[model samples]
Structure formats: structure tokens, C-alpha cells
Target: MTRAPNEDAIWVALVDDYDVVVKGVATMLDPYRDRVLVAELDTDRPVKDDVDIALYDSFAQPESDQEQIKVLLANPRARKVVVYTWNFHPELVEAARALGTHGYLSKALPARDLVAALEAVHAGEIVFSDPPSRMRTPTSQDWPGRQEGLTDREAEILALITQGKNNADICEVTYLAPNTVKSYVRNLYRKIEVDSRTQAVVWGVRHGFLPDHHRIDHWRGGP
Candidate 1:
């Protein structure tokens, strides 16, 4: 995927099931077309030859997303496969990298940074966004559900549950095992006076516990 000294453009392919996003990203990158060439592959068939990199946007994927990476890897033209996603959990980044993903970039990155990441990947660099450290001790401010006496971990789990993630999904993001997640869910439910996921979600909504702005920045036309 190396370009000659005179060659400045790096060919890229946007892979996603949503046509609107593909088109939207294409438009966003139009300003940098000379530097990052959006390949003319068929929209119906995202994987194709002559692509230097494949940017897979995991918008609403399940917990088991390795198969998605494998599918992109199977494409001979996708010399480098990158996962651009809103899910920037440390655990998810490590999992994607373990599967040989060249880059695990956050969707919140600006267009220029995204292009830089692709170029870095093409140059044989393993790129990943710096995920928040789970080891950091949480202060009262860290717990959005502090008034309810929910621990930092419990608050995080509740936020994910509000976003419709199951135990497996929560495990992937939090790096917690299934049993640990279940235990946390049980504890949080009791703390919040909820017995089921449905009640938890309702509580989260009523208390204004939505996914953080950083995670949803892409939708609001931010970097």
C-alpha cells in the first residue's frame, strides 16, 4: 500500500451496511479526495479489489464482531482493515487488535485525523484510540448515578443497558466476565430499585443517563 514519492492519494473503501453513512462519509471526505481517494467500488458490494484500506464503521453491531473483521480481511484488496466505531471501550480496542485489525479508531476523530490514521495504518503502524483506563479510581463525579448510590462501574453498566446492550455486550465494553456483569447488574438493580433490564432502562432515561456526548458526537456532525 505504499505510494511513490509523487503519489499523495491513498485509496480507501468505506464498509458498512448503511448506505446513508457511506454516502455521508464520502461527502465528509470530499475535501480531501486528492489525498484520500474513495475507491469506486460498487456500493452494494463493499469489499472489492484495488482498495488500499477498508474502514469498517461499527454503528449498531452485536458483541461478536470478529466475524465482521474477518469478512473484511477476506477481501484481498483491503490491505489494511480498520474499525472506526463509537464503541471505544478499552476492552473492545484490545479485542479488535488481537484479531489483527490494523487500526481501532474512534468515530469521533475529525476527518483529517481519520485520514492520518489510515495513512499510518498503510505505513504498517498499528493505530488505536486511547480508551479510558478502567483502573482509574472513580470519584463521586465519575458516578452519574451517585445520588442513587450506584458505583462507577454500575453507572457505566446502566448507561450501556440504556443503549440496549445485553450482558455479553456489556462484557465486551467493560472487560468484565459474564458472571461479573451479571453480578453488577443484580447489584445495580437493587440499588436503583429495579428488577429487570426494562426497568433499568426506564430509570436511566428518567434520570438522563444517555450515552456520553463523545460517543455520539459523529451523529451531531462533530469530528
Candidate 2:
């Protein structure tokens, strides 16, 4: 059951380069607003609020290897930086942990479980989700190309392609094996009906595959 709103609700800021991806996470946590208030949604910008948690959504963004997490961790306004991602390779998790990330959550979690995890992290506990099952259950999360029938992973690959990343760059950023990256590229190409990398990049550009370069401070009422 939905609880009454608490004045001390865990203030959360959803951070990602894609507005749709961040909004999707906000919508997933909407039913639990009383427990977790999504105060800000930042796209390609540093968070400006004094929030309890900065949930960094890794949809199409660089993973543990990149500097985004470090940037979030450096923000004094954000009390804690947690990575909300689909990739859970041990190396990536260790990298994030080494970078002082407070929590590492999975995209496979249901809304309620996700809220609980955030609460745990707020209470000064380091949290990490179990390795997701190979056959994953569908959740109410969103990605850039979902409307066009691309899974979140496929959408991520396409987004990187749109950013002018070659297969090698994608593999490095995503931590996927060379073969796995090639396979994802192949599948996404078929889904988008493109015959070449150039065609795929063109389709991605036309279909909102690029990162958003704005911020939405919901409480203040505009970007």
C-alpha cells in the first residue's frame, strides 16, 4: 500500500545523459513518492540539489570506466552516489567500488525493491544487487529505442554508435566482449533495418539516440 508522504522522504536525483532514460526511472519510482522523492533529473549536467542520493542511470552512458561517476562523487550537493545499471560484471563493480561509489543497483529490480535498496544506501549501507538471471524478467524501465523495438542493451549500443563510437570503443565502454559487442551491433542493425554502420548511425540520430544536454529540476519547475 502507498504510504503517506513523509517530510523526510529520501531526496533522489536521477542522473543520466538521456532524458527519457532518467524519466523512465522516475516514473518507475513514482508510486513510492512518499518514501523516495525524485527531486531532480539531470541530463549531462552536474546535480545542483542537496539530495540524499544521486542515482546514476547507466543507460547508454559510459560505465565504470568513465569519469561520470567520479563527477557525481565529487559533487558536494549529492550526499551519496549510487550506480543504477544493467551491467554487473565483477570488474565493473570493483571499479565502481574503488571509485568510492556507495551502491551498485541493478536495472532488473522492481520498483519496490529499488526503493528499498535506495533506503538501505541512505541508511549508510553499501548495497549491491545479485547477479541478474540470464533470462531476465521484464521491468517498467525505459530506454531511448524501446518504442522502436530495441531492448535496453540494443538501445545502448545504438546510442554509442550514434556518438561515433566504433565497435572497439563500445566494447571498452560497455565492458562487453568483442564478439558480444559485434553481435549486439548486428542485432540492432537488423532491428533498425540498416545495412551499414553509416545507415545505423543515421537511424539512431533520427530516433533520439543521442544524449540530452539539459537538466530538469522538477521542484523549481523548469530546466
Candidate 3:
């Protein structure tokens, strides 16, 4: 589908069996009229054009699992999808990211907040979890995102590690297991050639990956 650059168009599509959710959003965006064009999709029909953002309500009868989500994400313009569901599973969040979704806003957040989320994703920044996440810090030697080329999830875990949390803590916050966090750390260390946390911190700081304003002490379980 072709999108015209003439208008600051935010083509939004709603994939949900529940009509109320779609209607509610339509009513909410009613005031913002021409700024956003909302498309309410019934499962039977094909998504008309390449929309800028798509909202999927996973709890609906037809359900939208990873596989279904994978299909929806095939559209190049549907990069900034905001998913809503009854469950707040971190694994689901990981899955959505893997499927190319830029944000995951819960249905529980106020209706108005949903607009803010759509606005945020449309602005080109990612919103994985609501209420900005507080992750544990990893060492300087193994900074986040610049590993010997770790996967996106690995980079995410590394960023959490640098926030100063222990493996168990990371698991609790991310809904991952302590052992899994350890495994990621060990693998990342090996890939990045970092021996210890101290070395990771030193190297990270040197490379500017560890911002000066952010200290690692708090991430290590300090208050």
C-alpha cells in the first residue's frame, strides 16, 4: 500500500474482535480528526493499505499468537505496532520485538495513555514496556548493544545487567530465569572477550557505552 507523504499521516489499524476497544479508540481519537486515520479490521478482510501503526488485542476470540503476529508484521510499514492483551508476559514482549513490533502497551493503561504510546512509537523511539523499565547494569567490559554481535535479546539482557541487578533480580524484572540470565552473561562475556564485571565496566566506560550520568553501583543492588 502506498502512503502519501503530503500529510503527516499516522495510518493506524486495529485488529480485535471486540468492537468496543476499536470504537473506544475511534472515539478517543475523534478530537484529533485528520491527524490519524484509524482502520478497524475485521478478521475476514485484508488490511487495505500499508498502515503506519497497528494495534492488536491478543485476548480476542480469534487470538493473535507469535505466528499470527509474525504474519501481521510481514508488512513493512507495520513496524510500530502496539499490542494489548490481558496477560503481561515478558516472553510475549520478547516475541513481539522478534516479530518487529516497536512497542507493547498494555490494555490496562488508561485509554489516553494508549494514544501517547502510539504517538511515541510513531516518533521513531521504541517502547517495549510501559512505565519505562529499570534494568540491572552489566560491566564496562561487556557494554550493551556493542557486543561481538549478540542477538537483540542478548543486547537487551546486557543492558539490564549494566543496570546493577543480580541474575535473580534480572529474572524477576524481565520474567526470565536466573540461569538464563547467567547463560546470556557468560556467552556475551566470551563473545566480547571480557573476563570480569570490573573489566566490562572499565571497557564500557572507556568506549562511552556506559554513560557518565549512569552509575553501575545502583544496578548491583545498591539503593
**Candidate with maximal lDDT:** 2
Put down candidate 1 lDDT per residue, 1-223, tens digits, no spaces: 2343436688887765444345556766778777888753453332324667888765434353677777667656668888976566656777788889999876566678777888899899999876533433213112357578876557667877988888988777555689999998999999999888899999988875653222211212211
The per-model lDDT (C-alpha) reads 0.67, 0.79, 0.56
Candidate 3 similarity to native, TM-score: 0.49
lDDT per residue for candidate 3 within 131-218, as digits (tens), equals 3343322122122344357643565455545545556766765566778778888987777679987666555445334322111111
Residue-level error in angstroms, candidate 1, position 202: 20
Which candidate leads in TM-score?
A: 2
C-alpha root-mean-square deviation, candidate 3: 17.7
**Ordered list by TM-score, greatest first:** 2, 1, 3
What is the Cα-based lDDT of residue 150 in candidate 1? Answer: 75
Model 1 C-alpha lDDT versus the unseen true structure: 0.67
Each prediction's TM-score against the native?
0.56, 0.87, 0.49
Q: Which 10-residue window of candidate 1 scores lowest in summed lDDT?
A: 214-223
